[model samples]
Target: MEWLPHAQRLAREVVRPESRWYSAVATVPRHTYVPRWWEADGDVWILRDGQSNPDAWLKNVYKDTTLVTRVDTCHADTAGIEGIGIISDGTPTSSSTLPSLVVRMYRHAMIADDHQILVTTGTGYGTALACARLGSDHVTSVDVDEWLVNIAQDRLSLMGERPRVEVCDITGPLPGEYDRIVATVSVPRVPVSWLQALRRGGRFVTTLAGTGLILTADKTADGGAVGRIEWDRAGFMPTRHGADYEHPADDVWKGAMEGEGEATSTSRYPLLYPPDAWDVMSMLALTLPGIDYRHSQDGDTRTVWLLHPDGSWARARASGFLDSPAVHQSGPRRLWDELERIRHRLNREGALPVYGAQARVDPEGTLTLSRGAWSMTVN
Candidate 1:
C-alpha cells in the first residue's frame, strides 16, 4: 500500500534512532498484522477495520502506535476476510506492541550480533528484526500460540529469512541456550526457566508484571542473572501460559471506586492523575513495591485510587479543578505517604536513581539494584 512509505518515515524518524535497535520498524508491515483492530473505550473494545475506512486505518496504523489485534486470544480473523463482526469482548491478550516501546526494550536489552538470543514472538515483527540483525540461525523466537507462530513464520519467510519460529510458552523451558533473552511480554517474576535456559554471562531483559519497570540483568555462573532497571519506563502485557492473563480480583476496582467506607489520613504528597507518565510513580513503586493506581474522571470530579497487596488503599478526590485534593486512606501501610516520600526524594535530589541504575540477580531469583549507597532488592 502507498501507506508503507509513511510507516517507513515514522519508523525511521521516531522509533529507530531513539531506540537504537535495527530498524525493523521500517521493514515489517505492521498494517498487515492489524487489518482490523480495537481500541479501549471505557470498559469495551471498539472494533475498527481497514476495509471500512482505509484513510483512517492508514493514519492510525502509521502513527508509531500499538493496535489491539486480538482480545482474549480470539484472532480478528474470525470476523471474516474483511474483518467485520461482533467485537470480541475481553482483555487484550496480544498485540504488536508500539514500535517505540519495542525499540526501547531492545535498546535496554543491549543485544550484540555475536550473542545468540531468545525472544518472545507474538506478531513476529520483533523476531524479524532480531533475525535481520543477528542472522536467522542466531535467533530463536517462541510463542504459545501455534497459529500466531505459523502466520509469523510465513511473513518472515516472505522476506527471505526464517528464525526458529516455534510454539512454546516463553515462561517455560526454552529450546536452546543463548547469550541474550528479551521478552516482549511482562512476567510475574523472572521466570526461573529463563534463568535456567540462559548460558552463563548471558543478559536478559523483561518487565515486571503490572508495572512499567524494565529489568535487565546478566546471567551468572551460579545460574541467576543480576542487572538493574534501565532507568527508562516501559510497560507490556503480562506473560500468559495458554491464552489470556489470569483474571485480576473481580470488583477490585468497583469497590474502590464506589467509596464504600474507610478511615481517612492526610496525604504526605500532592496526588497526580495518570501516574504512568510520572517518574515519581516508578520510583514509588520501586521504593514501596506492590502499589497500583487507578484513576476516574466523571464530570466535575476526578478521583484517584491507590491499592496495595498488603490490604492498604487510598482514595483522593478533587473538585472544581483545584490544585489541592482531599484524601482518605486505610491499611497497614501509609501508601500515599510513601509516594510523597519518593516524590520528596526526587524533588530534593533532582532525579530518582532508577534510570541507569545497576542490577544483579543471584541464582535464587533475588534481584538487587545499587546506585552509590542507595540500594533496593526485588524478588
Candidate 2:
C-alpha cells in the first residue's frame, strides 16, 4: 500500500512549497482513521467501507476531500458492513476534514518550531498530522464529543504521537494555555475564555459561524485581539453542546418553507444564492445571524429561500437568468430586503470589504469588524 506517495503528491498541489508541514502531511495515513465513512448517494447517505472496496477507498482517501465518519451518534466504523444504503436521514456530526484546509489553517497560525498549539480533534487524522509536524509534546487537541476524543486518543496512541487529547468543550475552559490556537469548527464569536487562555502575543484562527469568514488575530495586552479576514475561504460545522445539533421543529420547517406573507415586493435583482457569492454571503451572515438559506434551480427557473430564528421567512423566484425575482416575505422582519441591501452594496463597491479590513474583539466578546467607514458588530 504505497498510498503515502499519492497522498504526498496531493499535498504539493494544496500546500504552499515553503510549508514545513509537508513531511507531516506525507507521513500521516488518513485512510487508517477513516476506514469506514458516509457519503451521499442521490438523496440518501451510503456507508463506504475500505475492506470491501480497497481500490475505490484508496483513491477517495488520497484526494483532498472531507470524509464523513459519523452521523449524529452513529460512527460509520461501527454502523454496519459494506455499502449500507441508509434511507433515513442523519446530520453529519464529525468528519476527517480536507487536508488542504487543515494545512491552510496551520499556515495561518504561523506556527513556530517551538510554539505550542491547540486544535480540534475530529477523526484524529489532523491531530496526527499536527503531532508529526510540531511533535506530540507541543500539540494539544480537544473536542466536545466524548466519543470523538476516545476514538482519536486510541488512534493517536497507536501512532505513538500521543499528546493531551481531552474531551473538553472547546467553547468552555481549555485544558491548558498555548502559544497558538486553530479551530476547525466555526464559533459564533471569539470566545472570551480563548483570550484569557492565550499567552500574550499568541495567535488564534477560526471561522465565524453561518459564513465562510476565516478570522485570525493575535492576543493583545488589552485582552482582546486584532486581525483581518483572510481572502482565502474556509468553513466547518458549528460547535455542538451535545450528541447532536439543535434543528428547527417540524412545524417551524414547514412555516419556513411556505409561510403566510407579512410583506411582499418585487426584487431589485435576480435572486442570488448566498453560498455561490462569498462576499455578499459574508455580509448577510454577519448582519443577519441565524438565517437559514436554501436554493434550487430547474432549467431556467431559479428559486431562493431564507428563514430566520425570529420567525421570518422569505421566498423569491426568477423565471429567467436576467430577471428580477418576485419576493414574498413573512414574519417580523423582511429578510429579502436585508439581502438586497447587502447585494446593493456589493454591486456598488465591487467587493465586500471583509478582506484586509480591521477587526477588533472587545474584552466582553463584542467583535467589531470595520473597513473604511463601514462597521458591524457581533455581540
TM-score of each: 0.85, 0.95
lDDT of each: 0.74, 0.85
Superposed model 2: Cα runs more than 4 Å off: 81-84, 87-89, 249-251
In angstroms, the error of model 1 at 197 is 1.7
Least well predicted 10-residue stretch by lDDT in candidate 2: 248-257
Query: What lDDT does model 2 reach?
Result: 0.85
Query: How far out, in Å, is residue 197 in model 2?
Result: 0.8
- In candidate 1, clashing pairs total 7
Model 2 residue 280 CA deviation in Å: 1.1
Give a tens-digit lDDT track for model 1, residues 188-304.
667788888888888899987656778888887778776777667777887778766554433345555656436665454455753654566666766666567777888877788
Q: Using TM-score, give the best candidate's number.
A: 2
lDDT of 2 by residue, 3-38 (tens): 877778877877766778888887788888888889
Q: State how far residue 207 of model 2 sits from its true place (Å).
A: 0.2
